[model samples]
Target: MSPLGSRVLGRPDAVQVWRNLANARVNYSVDEVRRPSWNIDVHRTALPAERPGPPEPGGSWEQACRLVRDYEFSPPEIVRALYDPAAPLLGRDMLLEARFHGMHFYCGVRVTGVVDEVRDGTDRVWGWAYETLEGHLERGRATYEVVKRQETGEVLFVVSCHSQGAPTLDRITSLGWRLFGRRTQLRFYHRCAARLRLFVEAELRGREPLPGRSPAVGRLVWAPSDTRTHHRDALAIHRVAPG
Candidate 1:
């Protein structure tokens, strides 16, 4: 057991500690995700879009689909909105940055799942979800999706996550989570969803989307490991079973 485990009891592994920061329910099915009994807070926001006269030959939702596929919303300004973006995708792992209630956090998450052509009716949805490797202030997976309804020719962006405050050694971080973490988290989701919609709309209109601007305000801490053992599991796409 690590020294940190002595304080928490039984949980001696830092890697396990990081993983536990996310809500365990994240690994459950999409239907389970929509269930009313999540252990942590659940959030959903419909991204607004103009019909724009059917999709552009190939598909109306193609533009939005590309945005989500390329991770337009995962940038520094979108992590928590008031925080920073990820370090970059290297192997199956990524370094994530964020600020909350005046504390800056530098963490890591492993790409756990990627959705490709996860079909819902005539709509095709694709996205990815990442789990905290270590250093994250919360534990849980956040999945981003771009869905196109073939019948309605509507493209929608959706973001969902199940998370709770992680056990932290920092006094301020712990206090901050206890006080305003949940509220701050919901705010991040709203802003990120809005930003994603703006980007998609800009692309659909043939206009370059402006980058979001948010000042970094908080502490800085890097993950304990510079790199993790590569995992083939990262490339394996976990497709949702059609209902």
Candidate 2:
């Protein structure tokens, strides 16, 4: 550990720290992760339609894709992400604060791939994926995608992942995983997609989505440049997931 890891815990340089960690490799063997046994999950939700072509300019598909790019769609009540916004989304390093029954645990993940393509006679897809890094609670890869149909102009948000628990030194977390992990995992997958849908729907309705966190909680400083404080200054009547 460097001096930044000292107990004093001053505001260390987040950009530089992430830059350094970006050089580090993911925790698990990428080769084996694709083998059988890892759990796979996929969730999809339809959004408002646009003209049958590329996503409408500034339409729901584009806005939803923006949220996915910046990690804004993540429900903070479940996970709060911190990273270098200045860095390109691909290969970016993320430090995630995953919340469980009120406990906060830190883990690391690195963006592994990105998807942007037009195929199948005119459909367009934009998305990216990240894999768990060393010290993560699990070994996994999750992808976020936004698809716009050419013929019908339908938009959809999709999340797919393959995951399994990893060995860790924390016994309590292991016990918690044994007892409540599956339930919370399902909740996370479902609610994350739901939250993204909520945001895009609100925007399509000509209103801003409300903040998912309390003003007081903004005082908590974890990164040098915290870009994950996503909700605020948006007009809305919608409520985010409760803590």
Candidate 3:
């Protein structure tokens, strides 16, 4: 059993916490996101594992999946085109601070689903997903998967997510979010797909992994307000569920 509990966020109603998060159903449904309230986005690319395989556990494909699950390529800077540079690593029950186009937001989520498999009928897939917690800006789930086609011997990387904007305290930020958030998010997805593919290919060729840049510096904390001041060098923090 997992150590995480039902309550994952520190603040449940920080903004749009309840209207449309990942907890609405058992598993993600691409079609359900078609509802008027939800905004959907998908990015997929082919990734060659470069080996013939049923993709057994501990194989290259699985290794790639582990990297994704562990957020090895999701450097704080790349996780979002523009970020605070101190965002926490992806994990179950973690709060995150994200910024883009001059807008900032705080949220939380927990690793809720995992995909591990061999050739199931025609494809071998492995990866995991994190479900939005109470204080999340968007109520939904994002899934990253590495798949290998059984017949063609091709491997692919897929990133899919279904979400809708939650209400935010700053209307200007919310407006900007409504207008350009999807585009920025799509960019993030594409970058992740490309990076993961590069890692898989490098492993296959016995080459060294690419060097990481601008690593995150500190733990996440809840920070809320304009009246109070915080140290510039403080560990990155998120004003998650309100205390």
Residue-wise C-alpha lDDT for candidate 2, range 1-243, written one tens digit per residue:
212222112333333444445555676775666645577788888877788877878898898998788677776667766675666788778867666664455566888899999868777899999998765667889999999988888898889888877665356556777687777888887877787788788988888675443322222323312234333312212111101
Estimate TM-scores for all models. 0.60, 0.77, 0.65
- How displaced is residue 105 in candidate 1, in Å? 0.6
Clash totals, every prediction: 10, 0, 7
| Per-candidate RMSD, Å | 11.9, 7.7, 9.2
Give residue 62's lDDT in candidate 3 (0 to 100): 65
Give the top-scoring candidate (TM-score). Answer: 2
A best-first ranking of the candidates according to their TM-score comes to: 2, 3, 1
Residue 199 displacement (Å), model 2:
1.1
Clashes of 3: 7
Which 10 residues in a row give candidate 2 its minimum summed lDDT? Answer: 234-243
The regions of model 2 sitting more than 4 angstroms off are 1-20, 34-36, 210-243
